[model samples]
Target: MGMIRFALAMAVLLSHLPLTNVKFIGGGLAVQAFFVVSGFYMALVLNGKYTDRGLFYTNRLLRIYPAYFVMMAIAAVFLFGFKASGTATLGMFEQAYTNPVTAIILGFEHILLVGQDILFWMKIEPDGDLVFDLANAPPAEDKPWAWQALLVPQSWSLSIELMFYAVAPFLARLNWRWLVALAAASIALRLSGYWLSIDLGLWQARFFPTALFLFIFGMLAHKALPLAMRLPAWTGWAATAAALTLIIFLPLAGLPDGAVRWITYVAIAAAAPFAFHVTRNLTADRWIGELSYPLYLTHLPFIGVVLTYEPPMPVLCAIAGSIALAILLFVLVDRPVDRWRQARAAGKAGPASTMAAATP
Candidate 1:
């Protein structure tokens, strides 16, 4: 499971780099795959480790925000101080903060990470008013997209993740039938947009409601954990291997991009419980898995810096630098915070074991 998580993070990192004609599961698929993984883990914890919803929320926040703020601070320095340009622009900042009300609202979103995802559905007018732009067009000479003000632009996914965390406990309590019904409804909504010619580009990927099905797939996977546990341990290893192979090689199989994506999602959802069953007890694997989140959060800044400097082997440099920074963050920030989070959970739920430490 850790290896799978790391591979998905790497897929996202590589996708963001300015590589040409590379074939792999893209950042979009990787993100959706991550949602599946998040769903599985949230189900794992919500069902077992968290008896108190308040404790679950706070532990989840601790898991996310510490490393996030550290990365956000680094991103702020690059964007505002050094004036790096990829994730955001100075013009976008000026437009965002031009009106006091807009500034306050955008500022709150940036700090709280609650509304950043909806920014994809809006654009900033020249007068600093935000208006709905379902098309999600690119920023023009006068109008800037509201999401452009995000210092860590990709943190939009975190907004989605936070929303999931908000309702996960309740969702985890549902019977498998109810869970399936909800997932079916969400998937129906996603398909209905395309069937009805609704042009749901803005909503399809970023919207929480449409994306809920992927997470529910994961929840369903957790419900299958007993089956996985009853299987031979080697089955877990086989499942992990098969899933990774599919992720890495499916693009070369000459399928439509959409088909490949759904295939990957189904493979991941099927493999997750088995993978987690095998990897949950391995200390080394868990450590590797811990790097995935910080790696995801911090990669964009390093990519921005590397691309700006135009170093030799820029892609390699970006990947190496991102991994190095991720390790530092894991060691310096995430580990300690995780200890506190785990301690809090232990206080509430008895002892905190590796199986109970599942995170997306």
Candidate 2:
């Protein structure tokens, strides 16, 4: 999850850059990587059965929201309170920051886990004529809400994730043929969804399939990777490494662009070795992975505050502050809620039960 979260934060950051004009790499692909990574981790984490859906979602909710809301509040404070600069001009920097009604609304989206589903505040670039009277200008000429540029942009991916979560258990319980069919159908649907998103003027449509595809891949891996997990560490690492090398060498050109979306399917397939190697080492190294959800929900607004008004402060300062905020969130918000949920889950366990991990 931490890996997913970090990738998510990276995705949002990369997504907003001018790099879309670049040919070889695009931020959108970063988010797609995140979806696959997310799918992989979810399958790994939720492989076990549970009798309580309520507890399951509750734990998930608790694990995600506390740090999320805290970051929102901090973002609100900084957006409002910080000086625009030593320069003398009153602007949205302070006014927007102080009132923070917009920030609050955006924050609410994450708290409600509905950030990605918001279709009303469409990206201004794509909807300029419909949304506003701006005319005779290309979509490129318009600037959307600054909020859209942050990690908030990928909240839509989270919604896709929730949909996957809804179906994951059913996927988990299926046999190989069933899983294989599910994957084939889902791959078809996923591509159709992306094409529809591109053609239907829905950016999020392009978004959901990325996550959905990754998730299906993750389910497949969960089914297949156990054999490798059963191998010795050296063998596991070697196999994992070989898989990764194959990924770099895979003929995955036109991956997102080509109808051969299955190329990434194979790349992630080959990359399974690296995935295995990392996951084995990850359970014990729980800090960032554990803090990932909080970091995901919180990091952007915190960044917004730092970069708000395009401050004259050095970029390093903003980076430093953001790191500090991430640490603080893990300490003050994420850890406590995870602890609370684990305790509650423990107390509610049945007589024969040993334990349940309230995974984020």
User: What is the per-residue lDDT of model 2 for residues 43-142, given as tens digits with 9 covering 90 to 100?
Assistant: 5555542446676566666755566556656654554466322111124223223434544654466566654444333333332221321121232324
Summarize candidate 1's per-residue lDDT along 263-297 as a digit string, tens digits: 98899999999999998878888888889999998
Q: On a 0 to 100 scale, what is the lDDT of residue 141 in model 1? A: 69
Task: Give the runs in model 1 whose Cα sits over 4 Å from its true position.
Answer: 195-198, 350-354, 358-360
Superposition TM-score, candidate 1 onto the true structure = 0.95
Per-model TM-score versus the true fold:
0.95, 0.68
Tell me which residue pairs clash in candidate 2.
2-289, 79-97, 80-97, 80-98, 116-156, 240-273
Q: How does each model score on lDDT? A: 0.85, 0.49
Error of 2 at 35 (Å): 2.7
Give the range of the ten consecutive residues with the poorest summed lDDT in model 1. 350-359
Candidate 1: residue pairs that collide: none
